[model samples]
Target: MTIKSGIICYIIGIASAIAQPNPDRPDLCQGAYFTEEEGAKALQTFASTYHDKASWEARASLIRKGIREGMQLPARPQFAPLKPIRHSLRTMDGYTVENVAFESLPGLFVTGNLYRPINATGKAAGILCPHGHAPNQDARFLEQAQQRCATLARMGAVVFVYDMLGYGDSKQCDHKISKALTLQALNGIRSLDFLTSLPEVDTTRIGVSGESGGGTQTFLLTALDSRVKVSVPVVMVSSYFFGGCVCESGMPIHKRPTHQASNVELAALAAPRPMLLISDGKDWTRHTPEVEFPYVQNIYGYYGAKDRVKNVHLPNEGHDYGPSKRAAAYRFLAEYLKLDLNRVLKDGKIDETPNKILTPTDLQVFTSEHPRPADAVVGDEAVLALLN
Candidate 1:
């Protein structure tokens, strides 16, 4: 009878097209406010029972996958830094944004945006901001990249934000699905070179952040490269498997990562550094943080930097980080990177925070440019230079 029940639960979960709540941890109660730990545990239960596309293994891999790989090794050859792609200066925040480009393979250039702050006495600490999937004009790379880049500048730090190749204004002509993901990963690594190359940048104190797809790249890049001193991956990490309707809405059935890179393992990459995951309580994909953070938190705890990894959840937001969450993420970045805000603000950094009205009503000014921002803006600051 008990075996039958487990089978029933799994079947029901599959039928629902969403994870069914774990009968074991009824206390963590789905769709309601849950303590981070409870959510983590409950999500684990759900991941094991559901068919989340290798969900259980992804969670397990987090704790064990990279034991042999060691830290700071060169990334997969596909994403290893190669020749410089192209570098240009584009306009953003009403000032020039340094655009860095690199070719992942032939006919493929991954571009990104770099923000240089004011009052740099020497090479300053830097941050790399990756964009989420929202038809990239670069504004949506991560809603807060621009604001944080500006803030970091004001605080006397250098920052770089680039659009992922396929998403923004890069001159790439093809959007074949698999190639895009590989290029996205390569762009993350090349971006590290871009930040370190800047004259006004510190290069050592670099950080990275992103949400959804961008957030996925943030941690992956941070893991592959040690230059990142801090990282905040909002809504990107997930139970390597499991299907949340809200989370899986647009996932291409064939294109997702095949192996699990658990939060535990990703945290291991940033073992001594600071890492944070901001999640939404109602989102279905919240399970990744749920199953991964507890174990990953322990890893950080073992390193005596337990406080470094924070799991912040918003009570009433969707998958993306809204204003309050973005603000919190910015604070986390500022505090960890130790940006010298007082100095930059006094003198003015990187062109007085470019403010042009963006459509979608709520889009704010963010400064990550991979290739360049999209040329056509429909509602505010609209331009068509790229197309012509």
Candidate 2:
């Protein structure tokens, strides 16, 4: 069943009232808070508030400020040097993969693999690949993640596939911290710092793509950072559904006493920039074509760049970054980032056969030989202390 359609039904089944936030609690918009009718009405109310570019930008500024303050982000966040550690270069079909780790904060390590073209000669586009809450913590090791990164590298873009907080080698603390949303956003910025630091990377041609929770990360990062030139968030944008995880909506980014927001508005913050929304019939994003897309397109209309924001809806597909989803992302990224899609095409079709799938052990960044830093903080409380 589609998420929004069943929200009230599910609540009734549990003998509970409709989902509503208690006034005493922080106004965190989670899961399906609105039915189709309510969501459309909310969009209408939002639209009526902003008539043109000037008003929309003013609203956008408030939304951005709400996000920063809600997340309790520092007025001036000090960034430490991303002391990177790299090794394990494995050459495959048209790309080379290297296991990498870098400090996003003092003693906090972000781990992943860096994929690059086998023989890159000039400035190439850089793509950041973040994963959702897949079965195992080792999301970057998943077949779909590997396939997309390798395919993009083969297409001549340097790709970095990194782990979310408690996933894979980023195990210094649990992923359920109160500040989970804040840390993940910071990690994304640092990932860009690391990606652009490469001598071969083109700073002007940066892009990001992911699915599910990763999709939430993709648009959130793109909205906050101007460096992201292209964004393809798969199966995660919804007007009624604010992400279910602490990492996505743990903070009060969507609601405060003075203002309110939704993922539809947040995603639209990528105004005039190239953004592709990938949705399916089985999840919260099922209403994309009707409910969300039109609202975002209207925002883009203010910039006279409505064509830049596009939606690819799959009525037959569910929520996953499978081959079909990857194909759509590939086409969009290539068109905007100037990547060579022909390299991954065979028989005039996208072929992912060239991407190598490796075991979790093979992609692990911390081992006995290359241990995690001794000074790394442990547990949720200790990590929170560092933020203070």
Candidate 3:
């Protein structure tokens, strides 16, 4: 019943996340398995047995990876903080917008766009928009979210889109790796907080979905915040074992050390909650059924939501989400979180046809209202105060 066992999962480096039977003898990443039983246990161990700052401090590789490769933000004393501001858009349907700004870490910030759903007379479904590993570089963020938002807007759901820390306008003017990642998650969580705070948002109906690095953020944020009702982690999840010591060298999301909860355990967290895992039927990385499918399925089985868990395999598609692929993702969300299955389900959205997603536009989300320096460390205190 434990998620980790004093193991090598993210929270704890117990190393037991994988059953390292012959550690002294041999067997490294190649021999590891990421199952709910093992992963959940590992996570639990990290929380209970490995609550030492020294344990985290000793992992220099992890700390450096956290600081250099990704976005960071200052932490809020509250779980996370989200604010609502008014907005007007031409493309957006309902356009009940808000300007959400909060302190992620101490000196870091994560802020960006927020698009509300249409027909929101009362509390409505909410979502967090975390961008990809490299923002505009990823098609899903470049066009997918905007499309999805409009699609949902048409259906009358409240959606929020915020740039991931370091990806959009959310980058820190300071440099602190560990704190940055922590606040990045906090940023997403804060967005969730803001959603619940809204009189128009249905806190219980909130959902989160992300592609690539955003996919990782989806899982991590959902896992930490129980308030997130539904989630779809696309193009990334289980199969890490494959990318790690298998067919290819593990160039993981954010290039972290890769000992977090595997996709298997990640799915398990969605137990009763609805979860959608989208993968390119023809993925470039080792995210195929032979690699990660079984582990994720196993996690779902543990939840008794094996039926609730689903994956839309896009045939011959590389790493990106198109209208067709995105449709499948939306269906899963509408069915589980929105309860609008009858109205929101679109047939061609999840088309299995292999098509490239929209290329990102060269538009920047941050503006002078809250500007940042070119190369700020995530941990800088001054950098953290910009959004606040």
Q: Each candidate's lDDT (Cα)?
A: 0.51, 0.85, 0.50
Pick out the ten consecutive residues of candidate 3 with the lowest summed lDDT. 1-10
Predicted structure with the largest TM-score when compared to the true one: 2
Model 3 earns a TM-score of: 0.64
Q: Every model's Cα RMSD, please?
A: 12.1, 4.1, 11.0
Q: Least accurate stretch of 10 residues (summed lDDT) in model 2? A: 8-17
lDDT of 2 by residue, 1-388 (tens): 1244234322331231134433445688765656757777888888888899999999999998888888887766666689999988899999999999998778788899999998877899999999887544666787778999999999999999999999999998888788999989888989999999999999999999988778889988898899999999988888877776778877889897778888899999889899999998867788899999989998999999999999999988776787888898999999999999999999988999878888888888999888998978789998787678
lDDT leader: 2
lDDT of 1 by residue, 2-64 (tens): 234323433432343344344553322122223446545544554454233244334435423
Off by over 4 Å in 3: 1-91, 94-99, 135-141, 174-179, 241-261, 281-291, 339-388
TM-score of each: 0.62, 0.94, 0.64
- Between candidates 1 and 3, which one is better according to TM-score? 3
Residue 305, candidate 3: Cα error in Å is 2.2
